[model samples]
Target chain A: MGNLLRFEWRKLWQQKSLYICFGIGLAINFLALLSAKNFGALDSALGNMCVALNSGYTSFLGIYIALYACQDSSQQTIKNIYARGYSRSLVYWVKYAVSLGVTLATALLYWGFNFLLTCCFGGEVGSFITAVGQALALQLWVIIGYHGLFFGVAMLLNKLGGSIAINLIGVDCVFVVLSLIISLLKIDFNVMYYNLPNLLTDIVEASLMMPEFTSSMVLRGIIIPVLYVVTFVGAGWLVNRRRDV
Target chain B: MNENRQTNYVITTDNLTKVYGKKTVLDHVSMHVAQGDIYGFIGKNGAGKTTLMKLLLGMSQPTEGKIELFGSHQLNLGRAKIGALIEAPAFYQNCTAYENLQRFAILANAKGQDLHALLDFVGLGNVGKKKAGQFSLGMKQRLGIAIAMLGNPELLVLDEPINGLDPEGIKEIRDLLLRLNREQGVTILVSSHLLDELAKITTRYGIINNGRLVEETTATELMQNCQHKLQVLTDQPKQAEKIIKKMYPQVPLLVSESGVEVIAEDIDSGAINRALVLDGVNVRGLTAITDNMEDYFIQRMGGNNG
Candidate 1:
């Protein structure tokens, strides 16, 4: 098991894109903070605010990281990993570990930069620390759901471009448009399973954006995506068992 | 309770079958590979060679039948004690040869195979930092063999190992596999469309066509059972083939783009020439065909697929 992790760690690191994407992710987070630097107290207040005023920035990873992680699956390298003596479960976890490490680092950098921006704008470190810590913690569950979701998408489709189109363009964009159109009717299906991904985004947004948010909303909001991870993980396993590797 | 059920063979299958919805990909198929013999699985394209390898590798579940590997019913045994490269060399193309081997060794359970020693063994020693993606096709193929040798696997299964290799690379891989078989006593199962190469090294041949075993025999018996043809490019080759088949119906005539082979016993070029002329067919050229494995394989699986 230790050997398999070492093997996958070495394997994942060999792709220069991993580091390139890390550098890019860190840069995006840093730039998000830098963009708010000159806004004086307001920008800093937004930075100290539960989430980035530019909450949409988090979606950058939705596109970049999703495609980046799926690249190995697209190229059939993960299949090669299975050819190695490790069990399918082992392969999933090693990829999970490496991908989590990278995502955690990126999330921390995002949190750190927001904290810096908060402090720069005359906000107390306490609020920044608490809010950013809570936000980052919530991001972990989101990451888990995303990880399982993308692995299933990538494994089933076996193509990064196709998976991205299906997930981001088809699923996310379509749901966003539907939610916007339904707003006039005052019908809120956005919180329904039909718009689960949007619900994840809305949940995160609500966690950070609420004028007075509590820990319970964060926990409750995470429940659906966690369930999603379980469902997709089981689906991924079934697909893997059946896929012609 | 049944000691005879467990044989010395490292790999064996009984009537394996695979079906996809409406299509039967692999029909009832059965074959055995012994502990030490270099078994060659020969078949044409889409003959379900890769499917069979995948089934034994536990990458795919068979729709019917069972496969035993390394003296056990563990479908995943092919994952351990056995190293395999199916279809093509699938390493992290971005990684160096050493790193690729390190992964396989880990899967095979090793840090690396005395790194420097294996580099020299596969003749990739001088390539200090060349990533597998940057290496030429031949270099990648050699690295693949080195990767397979990692953890000192006792059984090696290679599907179309020499698929895209150049002549030099083909010879290099041939020699490398031979060395592993001869010195290391590693049992190898190599599937290839190229029969001549397999003819030189394979101790046993398993001819597969449309997912059924047509023949399973030793290289020597293949030579003895099949007739040697004197390939003659005669104007009346059709007439000559008729006469030959009339005399020897068992030895089927093989016609290629180059010439026709009169499947008869111990017939010199002179006899073939005389027979063709007397049969009113002008003989252009006559060459005695060697009783080789390629000839045997072509004869066995050529039209059998259709």
Candidate 2:
């Protein structure tokens, strides 16, 4: 299993698509920061940077995971891993771990660059140090949920273009429909606010815009995405184990 | 039972079958690949050669029956001892030949093997920085062999390794396989439609037709079964056959429209010509038509599927 992980890690790192995805992530954050610096919103630059990073990574991570992690299935390169005597479950986990690591690294590049920009151009760090920490932590958890969701969709669809389309279109439609229903009803459904997209929006607000953080809000933010990770990744693992490839 | 099975055969399958929907691809295929033997698996397209190879490698599960590899009923455990390149060469297209092998070597736990030496063995030593996607079909096939030979496995199962190679590439692979078998005594079960090329290196042949193991025989046995007949085209074939049969009643002779086919190992054509001419049977032409591996396959499979 150790060797397989190392093998997958090396293979994953060598892909040109992975580097391209990471570059895109960095560019989106850079452009957002450039805009904030130009507009002279120096006091609120940190909050804008955090929201931009969160939104950019959340949208792109799914496509990145779909193209890079799901590539082996279309190329049939995963057969070599299994041909080396590793079980299907072990192969799936290796891919899962390596893909998760890659998505995290891309996320860090986006957030890390924003951190430097915030320190250089924005207000003093001592004022918003705790907020920055909370935003970074919440973004990390949110990215895990994206990784799991995209990874599971990739395995289930097992095609690059198809996985990307489903993740982008399918996930957006669900969130949009749910939000519309909640707005129309004008009901006080506290659980609806803790859904994935809304939960991520709440996390960003709590971290930067909002002054106080409720215990329930923080707890829901962590627990909900964690459950998303378990459900989607578990489903993918089950399908991959029985798949003939 | 395990001891007896392990001492000889490296691969044994009993009544292996695979079905997809209503179509049965393989039906009751009981195959045996002996230790140290270069077993040539001959079949037409869609003859279940790849299906059987997949089952043996555990790439696909069998609908019915058992497969024992390396003397163990546990195929997954025994797969570590086997090296295979089924269907096409499955490798990361973006990775170079050396990079691909290094990655697989780590996964295969074959770090002890020299990476450069294996590349050079397959004639891909100087292919530095050239990604596998850019490689020609022949080069990809050679790299596939290098990858398979990485762990120094005792058994090799390759499917159509020589499918799209030039004459030079074919000879190079043939020599490499021959050397591997002779020097290292590694057992090979290769499936190829190129019978003549496969015949040059195979010790034993397994002919599969319509998902059935039609025949399994050694080279010597196949040689004996090949068409070895002396044709004597004469004006009076009937008279010539009578005279030849009268002299040698033990030799099997078939009289045809054009000539008489004498099925014998040692026959003096000069003596037969002299005797036929003396008997007023005008001998126009006489030639020997011998059957090779290709002929034997055609005869066994009941003609070309084409």
Candidate 3:
């Protein structure tokens, strides 16, 4: 298992797509920072940038994670690993762990850059740091949950194009349609409030407005994403353990 | 258990079957590949050659049956001693050959292997830096073989290793396989559609038709079963046939397009040539013919189909 993890790490670093995705993220950050003055205040600029990084990074993260997850199957190289007698469960988990690690790492880098850029553009460093610190836990969970969902789709589909399409478009469409149905039915219970996207928005909003997180906010944030992570990773592992490569 | 201990077979399968939906891809294939033997697995396309290899390598599970490698049923542990190249040689196309091999070597924990030496052994020493996607089919196949040679595996399961090679490339791979088997005593189970190429190195053969092991025979037995005949190309075919028939009345003789064919083992060609010349029959040519592996395979498949 250690060897498999090492192998996955090496493979992840070797992928050019990882760097391309990072480059796109960096470019978007620079663009967003360049337009920071239009928001009218340094605090508002930092807050908006925090929200965008927390929520919008998922698009790039989803695409990048999908590519990483589906690479072995797309290139037909998974057989090499399996032929070495490694169990499918081991391979799947190692891949998930490595992808999750990279996703979190990229998220940190993006947040760090956003912090530096906002401060350089005259935003208060203390406020920027405080805002990031408050939202950090929920931010990490949202990234993990979304990564789990994207990785699951990639594993089940095992096609580059389909995985990317589903991870980016199909998932958002499902959530949108679900939200629409709930709204039309006038349901008192808003399930979307606990979903990863809405939770992300709520976390950003609450972090900007409130001084500290209430226990209820923290509990809901942790519980929902953890559930998403467990459900998706478990389902992906089950299918991968049985499906023929 | 004692029987298994005494037997030197490297691979043994019992009633191995693979079913996809309503179709049975492999139907109760029980095969044995002995140690120190270059076992040739011959079959046409979609005949379950790759599927069987997949099962042995643990890439796929069998619907029914058992597979024992080196006399043990713990396949996952046993498969650690095996290296395989099934279907197409898969690799990270963007990575160079050396990088690709290095990653797999790391995964296999083959710390002591000299990647440079392995590349040289596969005739890709200088091209190690070249990306695998830029490589030709033959080069990719060689790289695949090099990767399989990592960890110095005890057994090799290769599916059509020489599929897209030129004649020279094919001969090089053949020599390499022979050297690996002869020098290092690596047992190989290689499947190929090229029967003639397989015939040159194979000590044992398992002919599979429609996912069934129709026959298993050693080289000597296969040679003996293949037809060996003496032919006399003559100006007077009828006269030569008559003369030969009268000389050896019990032998089977046929007048073919080229000459009079005497289908028999150990024919005294000198005596027949002298007798035909002495009888004033001009013997244009005298030659012997033996059936090749292709002919034998075709005949066996045809017979099985019938």
Tens-place lDDT per residue, model 3, B8-77, is 8899999999999999989999998989999999888888899999999888889999999988888877
TM-score of each: 0.80, 0.88, 0.89
lDDT, candidate 2, A1-245, per-residue tens: 78878887887777777777667867877777777678866535456546755656766777777877677777776766666677878778888889898787777776656767767775444456576667767778877887888888888788888888877777767767877887799966654654677777777877766565677877776888788888888898888776776
Error of 1 at A167 (Å): 4.9
Model 1 bad stretches (over 4 Å): A42-57, A63-69, A116-123, A127-136, A166-171, A177-219, B1-7, B228-291, B302-305
Model 1, A136-234: lDDT tens digits are 556566666665666566556667677767655555666667777788789856434534555555555655565444767666557866776677667
Candidate 3: pairs in clash: none
List the per-model TM-score of the A chain.
0.72, 0.87, 0.90
| Candidate 2, B1-306: lDDT as tens digits | 564455588888899999888888888988888899999999889888999988887677789988888777877777787788887888888889988898889877898899999999888999999989999888989988888887898888899999788999899999989998999999999999889899999999998888888998998888878877789998788899899998778999998889899988678888888899888998889898787778779878768653
lDDT at B63 for candidate 3?
96
lDDT of 3 by residue, A111-223 (tens): 77777777677776555455456687677877788888888888888889998898888766887888899889998877776667778888888888887778888888788
Give model 3's docking category: medium
Q: Per-residue lDDT for B197 in model 1?
A: 84
Off by over 4 Å in 2: A43-53, A126-138, A177-195, A209-219, B1-6, B243-253, B263-288
Worst 10 residues of 1 chain B by lDDT: B1-10
For candidate 1, the per-residue lDDT at A85 reads 51
